[model samples]
Target: MPSPLPADLTPTELVELMQRLTLEEQAELDHLLTAGLPRWLPQVGPQTDALESEADIVFYGGQAGGGKSDLLLGAALTRHEHSIIFRRESVQLVGLEERVARILGSRSGYNGQAKVWRLPGATPRILEFGSVKEPNDWMKYQGRAHDLKGFDEITHFLETQFRTLIGWMRTDNPSVRQRVICAGNPPTDAEGEWVIRYWAPWLDPQHPNPAQPGELRWFVTDEEGGDREVPGPEPVMVGGELMTPKSRTFIRSSVDDNLFLQLTGYKATLQALPEPLRSQMLRGNFMAGRSDPVWQLIPTDWVKAAMTRWSPRQEKGPMTALGLDPSRGGADKTSAARRHGAWFDVLVTAPGQVTCDGPTAAGFVAPLVRNGACICVDSIGIGSSALDFIKGLNLLVLAVAGSEASTGSTVAGNLRFRNKRAEMYWRLREALDPAAEPPIALPPDQELLGDLCAVRYKVAQLGKAAAIQIRDKDEIRELLGRSPDKGDSVALTFVSGIPMPGPARQRTAREVPDWRVC
Candidate 1:
């Protein structure tokens, strides 16, 4: 039995009351009002929650068969006046087109060539279906205005493409709500990993301050393209201007949330797929396909464990070294890391736009360089300029060039490196090993974690000797879609002969002190 509706309510009062109703209550009201008409409505659970979400950006799907595509179509059909749904390829829109045709009962309003559906109503809503496959394909919709933007299987598109498309999302109609809805499962490869960072509050386990599912968080982008989270959704002063932060939230969806899918035996089909795809699709496990590649120099687990041990209030020794990676200009960032014994402080970074020259980068690094702290600069390309300026100031500085010959080898002397870069990176890897002395602690910075774990290495035989060869920086930048500035700064702190402070362990006669490894 259900409660009777209040009698003689005004239209405005009824609308306000409907707005305050829970999803289930709203559904009951819809059932009573329409008298079971053949109108489309959101299926209960994730679909209803997604349709009702007020977030500026909402990530709506995780597991397979979660009614992700249906939710996008349903929202466009009912709520939006002008909307666009995107897929990685135009061919992928076939199923969605068929669904739209069935829902509309005819293709009379659809323009096949333009891929736009014009629904006749009081407002005459428009829905567009499109694809962005190539790098510059997103430019096709440069100045287009859309109130509702949908990206299905969002991880298939590059982060740059997704961000660029969202820039054009706008509408002047007050009654038309604006929102970005993205749907996807866990990334199947490294190229898709940026999605995890974009939704860090909900997806990233290593995020310093994790957010609960569907919790609204506000973020504003700084000049250097880094996002800074503010306390609330209110406007804040940034660079002498009032900037409003956008609200974002992620809602996890699963097969169980879709009653129709559950009854259709789709879960069994997902279970039969090969791992780690099975885990990704069945349980929506984000870590499923993230197994360490064979050539990955630093394991993800090792970096995560080191981050877990880090604390801002932990006791620290004197600053042993400061690593500086300068960005001359362009999109790269100038980053610095301060090392205290085995503990590393959070990375400090400025965009290339601000730190454009050597003097500017030096200004940022000067405060961190104290007495007895060796300022280690990459000294390659623009970094050479910063190194020269630091040396002129009469401060102790170490110039590190990746192309230089390795000055040291492993404790066993069996592992030789092809270049100084290989040796320095390997030293950091050894320090992060489970049994390494003076356990390393790293700040929980998601960007730094990604950079460190992105590197790949190989053992090459150089005639009579085998030398470890690290993949070139250019190659790494291509893979990561940005410079590995943070990782480079951290690795530079391990320049040879720099002593780090840590707990001393009594050693047997056969044991050699492990201090040199750090």
Candidate 2:
């Protein structure tokens, strides 16, 4: 026989009874409060009672130990009869499911029946927990749509993987709006370009001050080349105005904002970190590892002063070859230089350099040609544009391919990109040294240092596990944001044919003499 119902109770009566649960339940609530709501907790709380707009997307961010999981579960519990919490870590997901089962499992409805719960709910079950750490597991999300979706530690999963899972959130109920809530800490790498570009606009530099949530939307370009806004709630608003059609909302939370993190544990955890991870995880700096262990090849001070000297100077002597590196639209950078057996910064043009969309290769090329500098640029993809401007000027454009070698090789140049870049970086590092007088002084350009800093290495595969690799394109693009046309041009110039000075060509009749004059 079923137990008797608590009573025919009013909302106030229900609240009182709910509050008067057994000591075990009270202890669990206290544990939840301590973990989820402490003042030192790293995420925002239920300060706003209003239901969020049915925006197509939403995001939550902050340091770890913030009641992010609890908030996500609580939000879903509001209107979602069925939900799925997608956890990247199996351990975390299992722990959460166990907690939910224990907390909401025993409570009886007014009818004195056990609260209903199911993993794969019937007729499209309402609640399920899934993991996405392994690539194949994402298969579970297919053909199964839910009204609510929650992702914990979103950054750990690949962007493509996350997108695939979110496709399952569609539901048939008009009144039941679908929601996709994601929470994570800062990304672990600068190469995670998508994260910074998508989230930077809405995140506060400092957290715990309560930020309005933000959303980033995309549109399909119409046949006429005009952009049409995709369907969704008015772009999520912040500061009383709807975000731009392409804007994204990023909610920044911190330990203090959580109002639940224990002060002693938070401080203890922070102190225990080995410094770099602590800065990134606790302090929330995406670029924290900029000059750390991987980049320890060069000291920070060497490049700090080198950044102040790179600028255009009046042409001196015959311009040698110009090296070029073409980019794929504004997504890459193009670099150029006239090397006298040494690299020099001629132009650093890209999207990030100035707020524009296309290549400025011509602008850079025109000046070098007028100065009689022969240019060499990588014309792979969209870089073919460089050819149009290269005509009539003494220039050579080459298509350079990234290293095809695999990871784990020794003798440096075995991996294409890092081999060439390692040499270039070494030279630049040497030139930047304040201690050693450089054979040639480069004009200071922090942008170059920024690009150099952005470059990262990867283990290249070379049939055997003996080759290593690192590509500079990503880092180079961050500094220039378009493509390193000028950077590539410089490298090419250093390796290409020399430029003979104008009106100073030698006659065939003149015999060459050796350095030894007898």
lDDT values, one for every candidate: 0.82, 0.49
Worst 10 residues of 1 by lDDT: 509-518
Residue 100, candidate 1: Cα error in Å is: 3.8
Q: Provide the clash count, candidate 2.
A: 74
User: Using Cα atoms with residue i matched to residue i, what is each candidate's TM-score against the true structure?
Assistant: 0.79, 0.52
lDDT by residue (tens digit), candidate 1, 1-518? 75766787653455556767788987886778667664577776777887898899999878999889988998899999999999989999998999999877788799989999999977789999989877668889899999999999988887767888998988989878899999889988655778898888898876779998888999898766778899998999886679999999998888877755654568889999999989898888887867778899998889889998898955566788998888866768889999988999888888776776666666667766644588889888878877776665555678889898885777678978889899889999999997899889999877788788889999998668888899888887766667889999999998786544334223232222121111
**Top TM-score prediction, candidate number:** 1
- Can you write out model 2's per-residue Cα lDDT over 380-462, one digit (the tens) per residue? 45445555545423333343333322122233444432354444444444445676555344545433433444544455554
Tell me the lDDT of model 1 at 386: 76
User: How does candidate 1 fare on TM-score?
Assistant: 0.79
